[model samples]
Target: MKLTASILLTTFLSHVWSFNGELAELECPDDCDCHYFRVNWVTDCSDSNLTRIPYNELSPNVYVLDLNDNFIKEVEPFPPDFKVRRLQLSANLMSELKKESFAGLNYLIDTDFSYNQIRRVDIDAFDDSAGLINLELQGNPLDDVEGPFVAVKSLLYLDISNCSLKRLNDRFFENVTHLATLDLSDNPLFVINNNVFDPLSSLETLKMNNCNLTRIADNAFSALRNLKNLELSGNNLYETNWGVVLENLILLEYIDLRGSGLTHLPDGMFDNNQYLRVLILAENNLAGLNIQQTIGKLQNLDTLDLSDCNLTLPLSEDAFANATKIRNLYLSGNKLFASDLLLALSPLTNLHKLSLSNCGLSHLPDTFDKFKSLQELDISHNPLNDAFVKLLAPLETLEYLNMGYSNLSHLAPDSFSKMTNMRRLILSGNDINNLEAGLFGNLTHLESLELNFCGLRRPLNATLFFNNFTYTDLTELQLAGNPLRVSKTGPLLPKQLSRLQTLDLSNCNLTFLPPEAFYHTRNITNLILSGNHFTSPNDLKFLELLPMLEILDLRYNNLTTFSPKELTLNPNVEKLKLIGNPWRCDCSVANLWDWANLEKGNLGILEGSTLTQEHVSVGKTKRKKLLICNYDTGTQPFTIVMNKTVPGRRPFLNPQRTLTATNRTWAKYVRESGCEQQPSLKRVVRSADGYVSVISEDGIKMRYAKHGPNTWSAAAINAAVVYVTLMAIIGVAFLLTKKRRAAVRMVVTADKRN
Candidate 1:
């Protein structure tokens, strides 16, 4: 009886398992793949050659369903009693969402239909669905948000970013009273109506970044009294009329208007915002700011981002005189001259961070000694020469110093000697041609050093003079954009910097690389060597040394072919940028093409074949065409020589005459010389043979050869006859003269005889 009972129990367990399996497989269409746990059923029918959602086969108990990455066009029907809480149908071919498409999904809480071809959302689509909490319709062609969502009282987060939203309607968010976050970024929203935010009373965060908004209507945020965070960054608002617009947001705490077209802040702009804490107005066109009157009003202001504001003048002495509680001040990308501006910020003795980059400042005044409490100071993109280095030598309290792009041609021997608390120092984009051996000897506390684009022609071989040093202190180093040609020196960098996380050597004229170039930097995470001329075949072996490298940027190099062996050397590389290389698109490079095709997501080729020519002619004429290498095998190679003629040509011969010979005699002499006879023979035969015969010697020779003896006989007879006739004529002329003289005497004698 016990054996029988065991058998029965075994049978019953088998039946139960089979039943559960069948239930899990139920309601799943034959074309879809489904997996189910106890309460949730996950179906993946995406890209399975389906035309529409198989709603009839959908399980009723499914809570999360993903139909994304498919070719589904329409939503026909769904399970009536389904209890779906989340549905993701992104990246599909759906063009429209009808009102009744999601009718039966009463318990749906989240819906993501992003990255679709959706052009419109019909009204009343989710009118009766009250359980909806989050709706993501981003990455669509939606021009307007006029659908009926008034019934979704539980909606808290709505993302409509990257849409075609041009104008914000007043009643667009009337039904979303409980919305806590609304993201409308990356839209063409140029206009914000006065009553745009009137209905969003419970909104805590509203993002309108990159909306191209040129104007914010007065009282636009008057009704959004409960808004705590407002992001209107990347707009065209040149002026900020805070008294008419922002004064009504009594509960506003954070505001990011950075990258806006604001040139200056009004005197009393923040006078009414008593609870405001964080304000980001960076990347604007502000040349100067005078906030003395309003500083006292913003007692709660903590973080102020004024970077890239084109501030040319120093801060007024009274600007932040009353703002004693301010902490973070981002003033990078300004036109600061020196540390004299520290006098204006002296009242804020508790300030922690300050950025003054791109400010045309060459030196820091000794007044920086006043900011003993300052922790971070970004003085990059200025003209900080050796003078500024001395000025910064005394700041012992500084923890982070960014002096990038400062045109710093030199560094004093002990410039950073007293900066004991310095942890991070950025000196990129400068003219620093050299670094003294012990330049950073005193910066024992330094953790990160960035010297990219510093015009460093040689390699760095400095050692920390301080005896209290270890391999775990320095964590990051960026030496990109330097003209360090020999890569063998790369390994000479302090091996004690074992904790380095990043090393950027891009744009360096590195032609050859040694095997141990990066052998010591085992803990490096990011390695960038883009824009370099790494022509050696063994250059790729450098990757083998960086075992921990995760991100590698090898873009814009001389890597003609991709090698899988080289890539496999760094198996941990997560992000690799191989673009901008002259990758041969031929059979020899077939492996590279295959790899690129297989890993299209990770690799990127330059837009066109050859590197873009940057130095085009500056005149109005069109650019001349460049002869790039031909990839087609059938095309023949040709060369073009641009032999530009000189602006003027020299005269063929000098006009001044060296001899007094007339034109006739010169011609006769040229003919005689060209007859191919000796110069003496030509002079001797000139009178006898006649000038014409000597000149036409070539013609006479051809005539004699053709006519043979007849030609020579005719010439000889004619010459002899002419010579005899000339002698007879001379004799007759002489006798005539004698007869005339005798006749004269005879006439005299005859006259006497007569």
Candidate 2:
């Protein structure tokens, strides 16, 4: 019996040891968390304050590793037999990838080194036995696509986007023959040599979008025989001759030349490209469709986008006469008149989607009934009216229609009754003052409705009317930018729209919302309440009732103050827009800074928070002070008087005493002040010095001086008087004086002579 018991006890002890061993092998390290998913073990060691990998304590069966969102500065050596297949080392401070960094990862198939500070990679950095299939090095400081892909022959997908690569050598992609997809988009490659793509003949997808390429040299892409997709959009190729450059790309299926600065295409531009299916030439300077013959050659083309091409001239009817195979056409922003232009496109019966937004089309003719096969029509930004509704009434097959900004003020009861196949209708930006009860009752297949900014003054009631329609197919409803004021109006929405994932009521003048407003919308992922008058804190309770609200836009409101306690009430609010508000910035607002810092400072959200609180503090104060001082303060009091008497000096102040009596010797003082004073003239007696003095009625004395010396003055005065008297008497005494003087002279002479 003792021997049998010992055998059983030994067997039980062996079983216990083996079970404990398996559990220990499946457990994660003390610093990490581990879980078993299928046959692979996943471990997350992020933010564990780990300076290096604890290889000894880590489970041996771990195949997936996550070291993202950590402060790991360097990559330590891995375990000898570590078999990780996918590794994530993003959001770290790794500056360089050395030769021995990924030595032991012989089975790593996917690796993400994005969002790191890696500036350079040494040659043979990834020269290991690992079979890497997908490598993502985006969001790094890598300036060139070198070194990291030295021996990665099995790499099928590689993304080097946003890496500032200027020039690429032929050998850069020589060994990447097995690479099926390569993304070099968003680089600064201003100059590309002809042989830059010579080694990428086996590449199926090559994206060089927004690379700033001004010119494409001959034979630049002549070696890409198997290339299926090529994107050269957003370049500076203004005068590119596509005949010589893209003539050999017969196997190319998709080509994006949007924003490539090509105004017009030459004849036979795409004559050689018979297999091309999609062509994107939107946002260019092409004023007119002068390439009718060239576009006619593309018989296999299915999609053609010419939006925002500045097409001011009317489209020729023959432009799309041969393009009957096209299914989708985008002609928005051409400022086209719908009546004249749609007449030209009446022949395209196979067109499935048509966009004519911002074309200045005020009305459409009844001839629009020709496009019976069109499933989607975007006629927004046109001044459409109730009369224009008849034009679209024949389009019974339209599944989606966008009539926003159509200036439609009213809707006839049977306006949309014929559109039984319509799934989505966007009537936003219309002057719709009211919607009849059964306006959309015939649209039983409608799934989405957008009535935002319709200027609806009254709230939508009549729940019984909507119950008659099939609301189970409704998925999204947008009534934002209206004047739905009451809070109780929220529950008035159709209750059968339980599948609604998005609801927008932003800018609806909603001061408050009832809890039942979102009771049926608990599954909503996006809710918008921006641009409204939700000033009270209690209004935020509507958001808490939504357990799955993901995005909320509260822009342009009057939320002046916020607290951390208010924000904690809604934990699932991922995206919040609080821009354009009157938020107060003070010490109490510092909690927002802390929250933003903790959230890694997302720019869009932090922009709204910081704009009103921090950025608008000093600016608002300065603006207020400017407003106060802008008014005109009556008429500015003038202390310097005009047309008034002088204040102090009495002599100068009195107009009568302006000149003294002694000064009358120089001149007379004219009384020019008023008509009260009159002047008195008086004669004066002359002295020996020929001086004259005068006295006036007011006792004013005056003196006058002679014109010569003292002796000459008296003699001249006496001689003047004598001369005047003698001159008067000389007329009669002249003859007697002259005779008497002569006789006297003669008697004196005769007596003297005798």
Candidate 3:
């Protein structure tokens, strides 16, 4: 139903939109697409191969002018009269901002000029649009160019990062006093004098990270009296004596000074910052800090990060004595002994999140019973045993835990029964060969479970797998890198996971799956079965089982032809990967013309993604589609015998796109290409046009041109008739199944083989 409705809506919208010369009542440039969206005229000239802005042809009432991702060299003066409030000109080729370039954009409120080659800007370029509130000039080559921001005094946000700025005049920010946020990161400025930022008194957030700075004046940030958030990460601030410059910013609320060369903080480092809440000093030499005097004195601080500081064992018991309000602490990269943890963090009764990952601990301290509110914990990469699971019982309120990469081979039954509020569990990278029955019976609220690379081999029955998971809330289950394909003794999935939306069984070496494999997981929307060995058209039986599946990943599998009618597929599932297999684009491919409205230029191969959250190796650079044909038979002329004309009626996002006999014929394509011939079809009628048309209740059709030579034998005729009859039966069943399933319109890997 969702797929049908989406197609109907796309068809409707496509008809209502046309890009020629006018949009609604406004005139548009020939190279631009003008859309009357909501109450605004949005002119999109991005990636239109524009060499320069079409100042005269653009609509005067364009509310949002998008000229990004173009090759335009410069911005000319705006049209004499315009209402463009936002202008986007990023990823362009402009090298300089000439004077009076934007002299007429009075209504401009926000503008972006990032990712350009701009190295200079006239001081008065934006002088006429002084009311502009936000300006972005990042990813440009403006090393020392200044005075461009002298105008736009009402600017509230300005980003000038990655511009190689090495120096700033004493009065660089002389104007823009109303600026509330400024990002000057990725610059090469070694020092900041006190007089540079005197004009920006209203600034609230300042980011100067990744700059090679060795020293800064003590009063450099004094002008930013109201600054609330300061980011100075990735700077060498040791020469400045623990950055004495930060002492003047009394109203600071969040400070990110991670990776700074800090061995110890002065006793009065944060004395004036009473409102500080999040202090991130991670990746610094924090082992030398007197926690009792520095961080411990911040009574209102709630979050502190001291990870990778090489903290030793047996920290002073009064370490966080006065920091009782701290709620989130991270010491992930430091190796802290289990016995020393309690004494160090026992005072933080309000602690809610703690991360001690990669801490080289073999056990956990009798985790402080006072942490009644701790909700998230990460102790991964530790050599913890089955007994360590018992230590976490005190954290009954823990909702998220990452015990992945631990040294446990077995899951102690009922070990997690006390963590009733558990919502997510990550036990990846272990050797837990079998899951203990009823081990998760108490996790009534669990939603996501990841057991990737756990040496799991499944011949387990669904009934016994989740015998006591009374709750039906588990939505995501990742079982990548496990061998679940030997032989199914029972259903592959459990009923407790009926509501599961995402299931990743990738790289499982699966050859074939039974029709009932997904019988219990009918509600699954995203199914990943990539990196398996499914070799025949009969392997498509899974499609008949998953009615609600939306995205299916079958890359890197041993599959060849994809006849949608072989085994009916849920029209809701759109992408079927046929990459990495020897695709014989024979007459069977023509079968796709009737079911798949294979867009002429769209030959499948679509871009794939690499970002994974469940640690599944989906490193496929591009999702393979059924495109490439065997070069030997690349032009092998074949005849497609159609019975009758069945006009394609699938109304989709592209209403103007349709497959017809007049558009293209398979025989015509074969004779035109210069590929080596394999002659998959007989030569007697090979020259005849191969046209295929299909779709019927239970009947099949084969209509060929009468231009072929009359060289048919009795045996050939019998074989042709038998083949057509068998296909007719399959076609009838296909339509019946699809019609019953859809109750609407029945229209709709990765490897080296493609």
Candidate 4:
């Protein structure tokens, strides 16, 4: 009896397992892949070359379905009781939406039909979508939109922007009472009626920018009492009384009126907006704004932007005197001098960030001492030099400074010694040729330094961070776009820079790497050395010591070979960039291929070689590693591969024995030359991989094939021909002299006989 019971139990368990397996397979559709998360399955059918929705193949367990980038024309009725909560049908050819299109999706909450041919949405299209909270109809030609979302009363966010909307009325938002955000930008609306937004009383943010609006009615925003942010920028508004229009928005905290032809800010414009914190008036013709009369009322203001305004009147002390709570002020792209700016900002003691970039400031005024609490300052695109930089000594709390594009050619020693608390410094886009040691020694807490686009010829000494036995806390340093060359002595990094994490030296015109180049930056993980002139394997021998390096960029260099012995990678390296190089695909580059394909390193080599007989141009060789080896012999080029038996499409490897021999020959030749070329014997380096490097007496190496159309080979042949022609000419001259002597002796003998 017990045995019988066991057999019955086994049968039941097997049946249950089979039923569960069927359910799991049923949820995954044939047209899409399903992935299960915490609650339900997400079906990804995007970019699947789909022409129509496989409604019958979809299971009810699918919650989120992505049908983006398809060729479907219309939104067919969904399956009955469809459990999909979100449906994406963007980038399709659908033109219109019918009323019963989404009738069966009872649980649908969001729908995206953007980037389609949608021209109209029926008023009752969303009648069954009472639970729909978000709907996107952007990038369509729905110009005469009247009212279609009356049934979508649960909507919270609506984006009908960029639909060529010309006008809006109260009927458009009749039932959207609970909407919190509305975006109607990129339209052609000329006038805004007062009661259009009256139904959306709970709206908090409204964006109507770039609408080509000409005028706003007197009480246009009087209905939105709870609105906190309003953007009316990029309009054709002119001579509009904003004070009366914005009088009812008592809860407004942010406003943007930029790119509007508002010549002036009328008096008492912001008097009612006591809680306003951010006000942007950029890119406007605000030459008549009396700062004291227009902006003095907002006592709670914290940030104000007035950039690109052609100010005609000089700012006085009374400007911004009432808005003492302002913490960030921007007056960039103006013609204000340092003295006028100082006078305007002398009363803003609570300011923390100030941008006076492109103000033509040549010097700092004495009134600049008022920025006691400032932590960030931008004085870029000016004419400030070392003298003006010294004027910033009073800002003890300053941490970030930008002085790029300022024509600063020199930085005197101890110029920035007073900014002890500074953490980041930007001096890019300058004509600085050199920086002395200890120029930033006092900034022991500095973290990042940028000196790109400067005419630097050599690396700065390590003493810049030698601050009384305490190493500088610098973590990032960028010296790109300079001309730091390789020195004969050794590498140019300080051993004490243990905290450094990132160093960018790209486009610096470097030629070589002295063995211990990066021995100091033990903690460095990212090193960018692209767009330089490093050509030989000897230039990368310093990478072996960097055990913590995670990313190494060697792109756009003149490198022709890569050997594991010279370019040893750390085990932690994850990415290696080697694009834009004249990679010679032969036994010489075998180690690099092995390293890239290794399983332990898991290195991602960007744009390595693929087997191809056709040679591509250097610039177009991205994602292709092809070369024209032995091409000038008037023969068809063959694909270089590791073995002859490998399939045409499979990757092959070079023999390790041949690869090691090629490397040994190269090293032996380099060592025999004493790492220096001999002056007497013209050094000719022959590689077993089928090329020759001719090193001149002056220690310059140029490569040429044994029999190919290389510039170096052509030049060498021409030189040999010139030497042979000169020797032949000298031999003929000697014979002529001997003949002349014999003729003269005969003439003397005949005279003696007479």
Best by lDDT: 4
Global fold similarity of model 4 (TM-score)? 0.68
Which residues of candidate 3, in runs, are more than 4 Å off? 1-50, 53-67, 146-148, 241-244, 459-469, 481-491, 506-515, 526-544, 547-754
Deviating ranges (above 4 Å) for candidate 4: 1-49, 54-64, 78-85, 128-130, 148-150, 457-460, 467-472, 483-492, 505-517, 526-754
TM-score of each: 0.62, 0.64, 0.69, 0.68
Tell me the tens digit of each residue's lDDT in model 3 across 562-676. Answer: 6656435574655555556554545454554323332211112121211111211111111112234353332334334322323221112222222222222222222222223
Error of 1 at 473 (Å): 0.5
Model 1 Cα lDDT, one tens digit per residue, 45-127? 54345577777767787766667667888987576787877777777898988877888778888787888888887656886
Residue-by-residue lDDT tens digits, candidate 2, 1-754:
3464456556544433332212233645544545433224677565445666666766656777767666777887787878888777767788888778888677778777777788877656666745888777766778566433455778788777767777787678776668888887778887667887786777888888888887787678788888888898888786466787787788989989888878777787787788888998888898866636777678888998888888766777777887788889898877776555656687688989999887777777556578878999998887766687877889999999999998888888788888989999999999876787677777777788898888877545544235744466666788887887565645635555666777788878777778667665577767777888878666777666667765776667777655445555465555666656555433223344334322212212333321122211110111100000011123333111123332110112223322111111000111111112113323233333444445443557566644345533332344345445544554456567788899999999999999
Name the weakest run of 10 consecutive residues (lDDT summed) in model 3. 609-618
Better of 2 and 3 by lDDT: 3
Q: For candidate 4, give the lDDT.
A: 0.70
lDDT of 4 by residue, 374-475 (tens): 999999998775677778878778899998999888787777778889999999999877677777778878899999988877776776656434355788
Off by over 4 Å in 2: 1-41, 44-63, 69-71, 143-149, 383-387, 431-433, 453-459, 463-472, 480-483, 488-490, 494-754
- For model 4, what is the alpha-carbon lDDT of residue 52? 89
Whole-model Cα lDDT per candidate? 0.64, 0.65, 0.69, 0.70
Error of 3 at 684 (Å): 49
Of candidates 3 and 1, the better by lDDT:
3
User: Whole-model lDDT for model 2 versus the true structure?
Assistant: 0.65
Q: Which residue pairs of candidate 1 clash?
A: 334-359, 335-359, 336-359
